[model samples]
Structure formats: structure tokens, C-alpha cells
Target: MKLYTLKTEIDAVPVADDFIAIEAPRPDCPDGGIVARVIYLSLDPYVGSRLRGRHMGEAPPKPMEGAIPGAIVGQVVKSRAAGVSEGDFVHAMEGGWQEFAAIPAGHFRKLDPKSAPLRAHIGVLGMPGLTAWAGITQLAKVMAGDVVLIDAAAGAVGGTAGQIARIKGASKAVGIAGGPEKCRLVTETYGFDACIDYKAEGWQAALKEALPEGASVFFENVSAEMAMTALSVSQTYVRGVLCGLADAYQSSGPAPHALNAGAIIGKRAQLRGLVVYDFYSRWDEYAAEAAAWIRDGKLAFAEDHADGLDQAPALFAKLMRGANVGKPIITVSEEQA
Candidate 1:
């Protein structure tokens, strides 16, 4: 087996070779466990913070030890678990950055390749999609005629949330993204009503202009500055979902911009913090619904792919810097046998 391990403690955005490849014996299939051959590895922004011990309650991995953490879509090559059989395709968080993984029972979900693309199992039809579904449908309860806003609108969560808002009958879906290309993706590709490019001069003003009626629901994925900006133009009693703090993930200290309690209090906003793990129990429910949406062309998603296991570190580095256009994925092996 082959895997990548941490080469050093990550201080900021990891550069080249922060993860090193090494050879290891294949892990044995333990009692009530299955050994799977990894196919697609999911790379996410949160991994950067987790690697530095900055994420919520997750300890950093020792240098050159432990498999780097990630989610994977794979095929079971061996099984010791009941109800799970050899050759089953599954998705699990324990797969890590390795060619093969031993996943314990109850820690993995079976995937139907016919339901959607295998890669989609780790992207739009996977955890990112589940996150968006939980925040919009479960937390915010987006309703008809509501005006919704989202930041980081090109990536998986933000992109899917905006689309889900529209699907649920929101009158308008507005997005705030970094560049013209991503802004185009938000509006044209994801079907948002308008997209404001924050990198452009006067974008904050543009966001205000785009939302004349003010936002009724705000799905926040960037920084506190952006959150304040969105809140400034929000409707009274807006439902705000705090999904991710992409800007502050690399920092060793607290978030750079503090929350403005006054602004939130004045609006009487219903602010909810979204941690996706809390929604894991609903994965099957969400996947079934989202797969239908994808089959019907109602839900759209994007992915940025790297070719091999060795490319994981570079792709991860790109993700931490917010350079990835969509869900970042690594092709560890062929999806089909």
C-alpha cells in the first residue's frame, strides 16, 4: 500500500511537499471491518486547519506519522463485517490519503454508482451537498419569495446552497464570489439571480445594488467582514447560517474579524452555526433526494481534480489558498474495476 503522511507542522498555507509519499503493508481487514481500495479522495478547506490542530477538537497528526485525514470513495476488496460484502462500493471518512483503507463497521456508507457518478459521491451528492441541505432546508427553512445570499459561491457548499434556495421557491438567489469566473459560475452555472465579484472595485456596493429587497436568508462561508457586509443589507429578522470561515482557517489565532453583536441584535437575526457532523444521520435521506435532483438536472455541481495520490498535497495547498474552483478531488485509483 502507498500513502502520504505529514512532513512537518503546517503553520499557514501548505506549499509543495508538505505531505510525503511512502510505502506500507496493506492493512488487514479487522473483525467487523472491511478493507477498501480507494478510488476518489475528497480534499476540503477544513483539512488545512485540522492539519495544524486549529479545527474544532481535532488533534494534529505527528510529522511523518498517521495517514493524513480525508474522505474517500472506494470498493471493498475484503470484508469481515456482516451485511457488507466484498466488491461493495462505499464512502468513508476514515479512508485517509492512502491507496487502501480498513474501515470499521458502521463507519461507512454504501454507494450506488448507477445513482450518479462515483466522483459525485464525494462532492455534490456527498457531505458538501449534505451540509448545504442541512443548513438551507433544516436550519434556515428557506421559504417561497425569500431573497437569499451566499458567499464562496463557486465552491461545493455555497454553490449547492444557492441552488437549493432557488429550488425551494426563493424569489431570488444572490452570491458574493472572489473573481469574474467564479461569479459567472455562481450566476450562470448555478442559476443564482446575480453574483457580485468581491475582488472587483466597489463590489460591496454592487452587492447592495443586486439585492434591492434585502436578503431574507444569508448562507455565510467566508469571513466576518463579509458577514457584516451581508448583514448590513439583510432584511429584518433574517435567517443567517454560519457555515464556514474560510478566511480564518489558516490562522493560528482567533478569527481576524470579531462578530458584531450589535448588528445581529439590531436585525433580530436568527443565526445558526452549522457543523455537518451533526447531520450525518441524514446522509441517506439527503443523498436520495439530491441524486434525484441531479438526475433531473435541477441540482448542479463542479469539481477540480488531481490525477494521483502524489498530487494530493499540491491540490490541498491550492484548496487552503481558496484557489480551487469547486470540490477538490484526487483520483487515487480508477473508480471502475
Candidate 2:
């Protein structure tokens, strides 16, 4: 099977092989073992961190663990289980970067694309959307009238997070993006109460004014600068969700500490690290709800399709550079519009 098997991380370079020969799944393996035909792929920043081996404390990925780093929607070519059958559209944890993948039944879930866009299985309707849901419901514990802040407002996770906050009850939802374009998208498109450009001068003050009442829930996507800024303007009993670190994902710089230790101590606020992996059990339920939200027009999602699997790596770089306004997705399908 062809896969991007990551051996190491080099700057501006991706370690991948188009056709790394490997054996197929065992003949005696479960009948549900199926041939996965790649469809849409999600290019995320976390994959870059995984390649750098930055998340060391977590369980490291073994060779048999799966593909290098990605999520994709695929069509089942062969299936043995009644739960899944040939022609079934499914999404997988490791996903098929190659043309085909022999995936076990358990790691894949059938999805109905007629209900939503097929590519959404890799974007808003997929893990990114679920990540936004679980992070807020499970981590933030959002309440009505609560002031919330989101970093990377135009991203797959943050964009959905901002929309979810507004729908749920947040009286004030502030989104922080890289520049004015995304800033406009945050407020005009995703419906945030305010949008701040982190690159702007006096951005900290802008954020403080945006959240005049102080942020109760800070959905942190960029850790270095934005994380610190959110903490500085956080409410006394604030909740900071450490969802992503776009700022410190690459370098080995000393991570910025959250605003003030005294505030967390004195105000009794909590800061929680959120790795969407931990909430696997709730994914199906989360996806169902999030998809419903989208169908109902409560949650709006935008995407940045970079086109083709070959362009996936470059799109990842673009995402890190904040060039994409939404989830950067690449498709294996030859049809490009």
C-alpha cells in the first residue's frame, strides 16, 4: 500500500513515499476488513507537530499504528460485515493517503454524503467539527451570557467553535485571526461578536475592548501569543481550552505561560489541554449533533481545498502560515473545479 510513512521532520520538507510497498491485511483478519478508496483529506497543523515528535508524552505512533498523519473519507471497495458494505462511504482514523487502504472495520465509520458534502467528512462535518463541539461542551462548559474568545477563528476547529458559542449562549464571542480578511470572515461569516487581527498594533488592547466583560471561555488554538493574550484578558474564573499551538508547533522555544498564575490560583480558573484524540468514544454522537447543526443552518463552515493529494503537504505549510481561511483539504479525485 502507498502511504506517506513519516520517518522524520525536516523544515519545509515532507517525508512521504508515493508507493511504499507493504503487505495487505491478514487473510484471517475479520471479514469487515475492507479496501478503502481515498477521497478527501484533511491537512492540519497537528500533523506537523506529530512529525516533529513534539507530543512526546503522549503514546507514540508505531509503524502499524497507521499512515503518517492525516484524516480522509473513503469508499469501501470490499466489505465483509453487514454494518459496512461495498460502496459505503466511510471515514477513518489513519485514512487512506494512497489510492486504496485495507482498513479494519472498527477504525472506520459509514457516512451519508447525500446529507452533506462528501468532502465535509474531512472538514467541518468530520473530526474538526467534532473537535469544536467536544472541546466546548466537554472542556469549556459554556454558559449563557458568558464571554468567549477563539483563536484561529477561520480554522476548521475555531471557526466551528465560534459559531457553536454563539448558538449555545455566549453573549460575547471574540475571534482572533491573522489579518483583516479572516477578521472579516469571523464576524461577517462565522458570526462572532468581534474579530481581532493578532497582527494589528495594540492587538492586546483590542482584544480587551472586544471582551469588555472579560473572556469566560478561551478556546486557544494559537498558544504563543494569542494564548497569552487571552489569559491576560480572561475572566477571574476563566476556562482556557488548549486546543492547538499554531504559534509554538514548530520551534522549541519555551512555551508561553498562561496570563498570571495568581489569577488561576486566586480566581480559581482552570486551564485544560485538549487533544481531540481523548474524546473518541463521543465522536459519533458529537458528529451527529454537529451535522444537524450544519443542516439546520446554525453552524457555517468554509473550506480551503488545495486540490490533489500531491498538493496536501504544501497546503499544510500554507495552513501553518495562516494562508488558508478554513480547513485546508485536499482531494484525491481527478475532477477539480
Overall lDDT per candidate, in order of appearance: 0.89, 0.73
- The numbered model that scores best in TM-score is 1
TM-score versus the correct structure, for each prediction: 0.97, 0.86
What is candidate 1's local distance difference test score?
0.89
Q: Give residue 265's lDDT in candidate 1 (0 to 100).
A: 96
- Candidate 1: clashing pairs of residues: none
Off by over 4 Å in 2: 1-31, 56-67, 252-260, 334-337
User: Which candidate has the top score in lDDT?
Assistant: 1
Which tens-of-lDDT digit does each residue in 237-292 have in candidate 1?
Answer: 99999989888875556666667999999999989999999999999889989999
